[model samples]
Target: MREILTLQIGGYANFVGSHFWNFQDEILGLREAGFEDPMIPTHGLNMDVLYRQGETRERQATYTPRLLSIDLRGSSGAVNPSGSLYERPPPAVVSSIHTWQGPAATFKAERHERNKFLQSLDDEEAQYREQPGDAKAEEIVDVEVNERQRYIYQSLEEEVQFSTDYLKAHLHPSSTYQIPGCWQGVTPFEDYGTGQGLFSSSARSEEIRDRVRLFVEECDTIQGFQCFVDDSGGFSAVAADLLEDVGEEYGRTPIFLFTVRPPRKVYDTLASKKKKITHALHDSVSLARLSSIAHLTVPLGLSQVAACSVAEHLAILDEKDYHTSALYAAAINCITLPFRMEAVGPSDGSQSSGLGGTDMGTALPLVSCSDSRRVAMMQASFPSPALLESKGEIFYNLHNTSSLTPSTERPKLGDRVAKLLVLQGTQLPGTTGERATVGQVHKSVVKAHEITAKTGRFSSRLATSSHLAISECPLAVPLPFPFIFGNKIGRFGNILSRTVGGGKQGRGGLDVSSVPVGASVSSSEAVLPYIKRRALDLQRFALSRSTTGPSLLQDWGFDGEESKDLRERLTNMVAAYSEMVESSSSDTD
Candidate 1:
């Protein structure tokens, strides 16, 4: 019964945020064939996001309370968000109602005495001056004054509420997809750049306040909090602020952060150098600052796929790497499984058997709460066929074994320390349930807890003649996927493949692979060096540019020197990535 609030900030984040919710919704069986008692994820809240971009029209048109509750009872025939009455049934229909409380005899005696006293007023001049009926009277009337004040206050409150609701209704968080009993932050359409206006907007602030007052405080057995921050400045800022406030008051309530690194879009030829450099710098500074706020932060990058068993082995011509998000989105569902589906439950004959997993309330401390503040990133691995199609299927079977080796097993091989979220295998995907063996759990736990090695130590440099390096494995990720709305697909292949064993990569981007048949497996080879290098270049450009670059950094509470420091640290990794891409490219002479 432990509760954790899920906060989604920024446009892309909302997409991923929705996937996270969808996963929970599927797991708990809160949809069509409802579970006996479906529950929110043990990892965090269902989700509250400031969504922009691709929002459903229904969500776009509504202004729901940032905080809300759902009635699975179907009592709420329509979408009525009426105050507290939403929970309890309206006062039962009654036979008769009496309004008067006083007896007729007592009322008449008091009235008679009052009339006599008023008639016998000894000081006519004093009484006349005090009389409110007199136009010239100067006396103050407390009752009238209170009444007017109350009217004005009520009107103002109503007006303010209306305006806020109007704006909130348009936000992605306020949309129809939101879960019952879940609270959301106000998603305002008015985005003032990335940092403040989006995260600390008036609406955003009010929503946070409401979330704390309503959800956080109300939960009697609340555990920790988990936040998903997009690369946007405001989203992370607000998330940090809210977590800090709650942490100060709640004392030691662990807050885990899942932040999406700004994808590298500069590789596109049409992209201007100025824009590329600007984005890179902006992202680096934002990530660096965000890293410090969360107790433990997991940063995700699109470049992660460069280290995969298949993709890295082959060459990808599409520089856009648009599928990176899709891949990450799928990875997110798998990696977070340890926390979300703590214990597997029994299937009640649901079509997918997705509800076989149970909550790991007792194991909360194992995954959700991280004491180490250092190492704010982890490497991400996604199996073949992108996420939108695979649903939650775990690809790259041979990558992990029945003996789940820790992502950090080879600690001494590299100098740059890193962690990997190697969520391998296909089990409990949305609508598709692959029985999870206790042996698998044992392997996953054994490796998940093990602290691994650093980045490449002796790996050859990319372009530079330098010897320093980082293994793609060591690059830090949030330990969660980069799921988004449309990007997080649940392609379970054909119903035939789903029913049988692993086979082919389907047109729907579904994986046909059933159980691991051979020695081959799926694995994530982190191309972190490329990711860090890209960020470094962006940061360097930001620092090298005019005062505007530095000012932008300052505006977001990041200083110039720190940005420079980060770039410096990423020097080796960047070089290694450059070499890998160069050597890996088929066109290379």
Candidate 2:
């Protein structure tokens, strides 16, 4: 099995060949931090690392055309006679479903289950209406727990709905054919030209903003949280309290903020007229009308679910309840779900979901506080970069593998080139412009191969660097594991710092050539001799003195004729060193 890491880039035009191409910058950063290439097996390790285990076969290499090259003018992919193109062709859909079925469906089912649990609590609350407050203490606490959980779920569902609706509204024109002059209020584009325009809301908009602040303030009180941490780790609980007091006095309860904007096609369809004939007495009226309107559309099922939940909340809530702190919280939660969206127009494709359209309805379950223990166990077992770098235990032997082992096979040309390019980070200049400079390459080669009187020594020096550099390419991808489990990592906070820190001692540093010329030698012309002397010095002392362990030269999985060539070159250098030492000794005697 083979694994292929596909690079994804945001823009192909600007970053086609640069390090930033396909997010290489981020991937490289991850590599430097100790991540390893992902391994893929068809039958196993296909699931999340939290669940999967055992050795996995890697997948074949895969690459895609740049994202920027996608044709947006009509549809996507091959065009039919009617000029229709389908984006996200069927193979992608099948792949997505096959890979994510468990994770996606589980999340949806979980939300439904949570809703049922909340409903049960509501029923229990109704039965205790006649009891005395102090006498039913146990029941009251139980009911409160249930109510709180239900509130959280309800809030989440509403937030998901609102989010979907907001997106839908943003995609469609605010005014329809029935209302020609109608506008989607509070256009985000009002502040387009003037950056400051976005911050300066109109009076009515400010009123809405104030209401939102009040709702958030009330939410804090409802949640029983007295303080919240700012980015700097400072606490601010009193600020909301003060704001609430003023809002209460004014009877201005905050409502959650909502906005909508016009669709792009509306302006594009507007007619433009340039009159060429100059009329002596012209008072002509010209009118531009939209010939046809293209309806904005998104999937229907998601919006339907969101709409149903929203309708239920709207029915239950009083006018004042609409402005309640809980309402805002609930709205926010409902709209944020992956499936939620506003219904703009009818769906473009068929309504039958599973039969024709690939099922893309589900999401991963939200990790609950109660499941923390199980999650912790899962996390502990995963192979995070920190664990690999910690050098806690050598799980796989990088250096002692058998000669015929799969791991020791000769690398492909691309792999060798990748290694050398990666190594150039340390040995040559880091920047492309610097390394690509003709003068620098000439100087580096002349200095590195000074002892050799041969004219074509630059190519030999480059080859030597490539041979030594091929050992570190595997670290370019992330390991398929987690560093820690449960509350151990504390929600993305770094917990394996020590492991990563300790392992950094064996990490690579900048590759610099040492020259052997005289101490007083100076000048660009003297560089070749100096570099040659330094190369000889390294040959003699690099094993004990260089930062990287000398054994690492064999760890990078070099094989085939390439490895033989490198070994022969090193052997010749050693012999030359011995002869030079003997000659110098004889002269001294």
Candidate 3:
């Protein structure tokens, strides 16, 4: 098995990562529930790719994600930092202290209480421990225990204020790290320079490196690392340093970075304007630095998700990180599905020439365009309707969810772009909703590509180099998944011609279980505009002395020299895309 190490930096990134892991936990649960079918085959996916098997001190088996998650102190909420596999000792009493007895005054802080969902999980575990090993008894206990938990999970919109509130997976003790002296609301970790030199401390750096080495040494064959970094703040700097260390130690391993941000809010105050400018500068600098370290960088999140075409059928709350993160997590889950798929036979119509499913090592290069384009955009269509439901339409409409925007002007003739498409659990529309075969899925994608090119949804003159992958397994909606889908979505994720009246309503009055997803990672000129915009933002702030840009950057610890270097890097990135387009134009001539 080729194992992949996952890393998540910052609170928002962890919010997205929590949802992503919940999806995986749901898949594992479904497989255990004997929910496999021809339409949704779980056996074809190898869970070992992202998970590790181990035994607890009590000789009981435990399966946990091979992940390293970092966040500010007190960000973990009710979840224990040591994890659930081991028992936690109770808080020590002040009376038990023997030292410092003179003039001692004790003040206890209130601890975060677990929500109903977590409490239910504890109750279920206790019930299981008390019961005998009879299969029927265990089944009965599970059903009874899950009843309340399911209700709470589905109704968690108001309760899930933090990532840990809805988290379903049990992380290993060593997988979580909280930065000392950094509290979410109290500390100012809002810029790239705030996180600089955080890992420079020898003790902290060595501890993180040792933990990473422990996970790496256990894997038989390590494929690469998949990282999620919060680019809106200091986490970006933290991730850059971490990735740099990983690169130095394991130079051959590939790194795929997803720089994520939450929905941006608008304000018109004078102070707010200055803050916005600071944020823009931070974003540009973070992107330039982080993208240079990772093999492939995909920027995610939108200023307003509800304004996007992808959310047309869905009801989204722009202010809620729970809703926005779920949307991004679904796309990430679908795109990364191929990384863990079991290799079987040759690649039918898939892009890669290799046999079966593609790995990160092979898949990264396909979209990166041979390293000439390291930055790419991602688009997704969630709850993609079945063929029959859409009047025999084979392909679902895709919308760009990444920050990159397509140019208003038509692309020049002979402009070539590359995209890696992953379609999951596409059904043939009808009451039966039978899963489409590999050939059917591939044909539909090709037809969609041709139609898209003609319609100029991407660009009329642009020639797209498309690589397709199809999976029979759809994304399972875990209990804790946010109810962002509309009432028009059916229980199994099919699109109803009309919205359902009412039944057992969850959040947003929808009850969706599994969803077919269409997601793609593309390397094209579409990213040119985004790169250029950031580059201009950096240059405008760095060179203009009239504005507070230089002073603000200096406050964040970026000297004049570092600011100049960042601008140069952004310039080079923009030039890379510009050169690719010119080279393609010349080849056509």
Candidate 4:
């Protein structure tokens, strides 16, 4: 079990910083399922930003550290962070060892003692950085970035001198030590303090400290480090040589190569569009003449849409020739995403009912119709009179196959029309066990029975008087029929001589709803009932802009005080939602 758990933790750590992983998609799906913000994607990244959001701030109103675990291990073992054995669990004892060690024994106590002993050894080693035989106080000056190279030289000299003396005393042949003594080149060894914290103390001293620190002691594995600068300023000859020597000792490569880049300044050229100032960098210490590096590619404007297939095609096409032969050739093979366009209603921004805006210089018309009569107005291809009176007995057939293509070939004209008809609002139905669609494509299928009867009754009601009293909330909006419908019935006239798909001529201000077949009908019925179930789904959605309080507050421009207020409000809302759900479920029960 431990091995399996360890593997799982390792796998998680391996991808800890990987960006290409699809964490977003997985989290979005969770959001759609109604998970609260705290349990979802918001917890994944950019945690600090989220804390500023309004509601998030409120949720953390209470804080308590829950004593979440009890350690069962009772064994003595060395805790070596660098050893491979660190990954394994320590051996366990059959009985409690704390009884013998006493109540004072604890992991913290053991760790503290170990650390104190290590500190003593470190303090003793610090003496090496100063004078020998006579201890004198020395100032631990902060390293400056500008003096980094010089500092590296001084630190390396101390380390090399100490190492040479030690080697001569221990492993070196007698001759090397005798020659140094005879040549009067032997130097007393001095101890340099630990290089830790020197790199960040000050920019100048840090550079010098870091450059020579590696030579203080040899390490089995050498990790290379880098720093970026606006200009080549602190590199030195001794520093460079010491680095190369250290690298050779560790079988690593080392060199200080400087590259000069173009300075930032304003300049202009006779180009149609503006461009940023840029230039390639070249190595300074090259033995031969240097060649130019590859030019950087910078994407701009429409070219950036290459990441999306549909955007790429649209960006390339011109509006004037968008539907011409050339466009067909270009777009035919273009990868398409499922496009969905909805006529958002003004009230809820949902496609729920009658259109918004005026029907000319007149007040909005409220018309009434019987359910049966209204059903007749909604037809598939055409309406059958017998079935109209028969109620919605006959099912109307409408194909939404335009967007669909055959497995072996491209979409045809019929498929395109089918897609358009479905988008325009048509109804289709099927049973649970059916292999194909339930409705048939009859030449003159009747719409639902109730709508047909309603339209007829409405006409009869209008014929009775010139001034008809419209209801407060009528079943339908009485759009003025744009074209003249003479007493001649069953004849359909063009409401707009030209509209969008009505050819090149533009459409006049007319009630478009009256002209199109089943235009007043809801567009949702065309899809299967299961697809429409999305409306009833009780999924939690973000009312607040962000999942976290800090981020939500920051994004909505809420100040600290305002954020605190909003957070409290959100907490109340969450409580309300929970109560509502519980009440609803209780009622159902």
* Number of the top-ranking candidate, with lDDT as the measure: 3
> Against the true structure, candidate 1 has what lDDT?
0.35
Q: Which regions of candidate 1 are displaced past 4 Å?
A: 30-194, 197-204, 232-251, 261-273, 303-326, 342-436, 440-548, 554-589
- Could you give candidate 3's per-residue lDDT for residues 486-535 as a string of tens digits? 77777677777777745534333225667888787877776788788889
Q: For model 4, what is the alpha-carbon lDDT of residue 576?
A: 34
Clashes of each: 57, 39, 0, 46
Per-residue lDDT of model 4, residues 1-589, tens digit only: 0000000001111111011011222223344467633211122122111011111223523111100000011111122211121133375455664456445422332321222222333454576555665323222332342254233322322232111111101110100111011111122110001111222235533343343342222222222211111111111111222233334443422111111111111113542221111100001111001101100000001111112222221222222111111112111111000010112234421323222222101110111111111100111111111111124444432221111100112221111111111111112232111111112222122242234335443222211111101001111101111111212111221221222323222211121211112211111112212111211111111123322423322433345664344334333323432342354345444
Judging by lDDT, tell me the better candidate of 3 and 4.
Answer: 3
Give the per-residue lDDT of model 1 (tens digit) for 1-589. 4555555544445445534443333323332344322111122212222111232334433322233221111222222334221233375364577686876331111111112112222243366567447553434565574454334322321232111111112222322222222223333221113444333456655655564555555454555555655554344544555555666676766655666633442235577765455455655555444544555555554433434442331222222222343344444554444343233344222222122232223222332223222223333333222112133333222133121111222122222222323332333323442333334423333332231212333232211111111001111111111211122222321122223222231121122211111111111123343246546555556566453566655665556675566565455334543443454443333
Judging by TM-score, tell me the better candidate of 3 and 4. Answer: 3
TM-score of each: 0.46, 0.15, 0.87, 0.15
Give the higher-TM-score candidate: 1 or 3.
3
TM-score attained by model 2: 0.15
Query: Each prediction's Cα lDDT score?
Result: 0.35, 0.20, 0.77, 0.19
Q: Which ten residues in a row have the lowest lDDT in candidate 3?
A: 400-409
Return the TM-score for candidate 1, rounded to 2 decimals.
Answer: 0.46
List candidate 2 segments past 4 Å from native.
1-160, 163-202, 205-589
Stronger candidate by lDDT (1 vs 4): 1
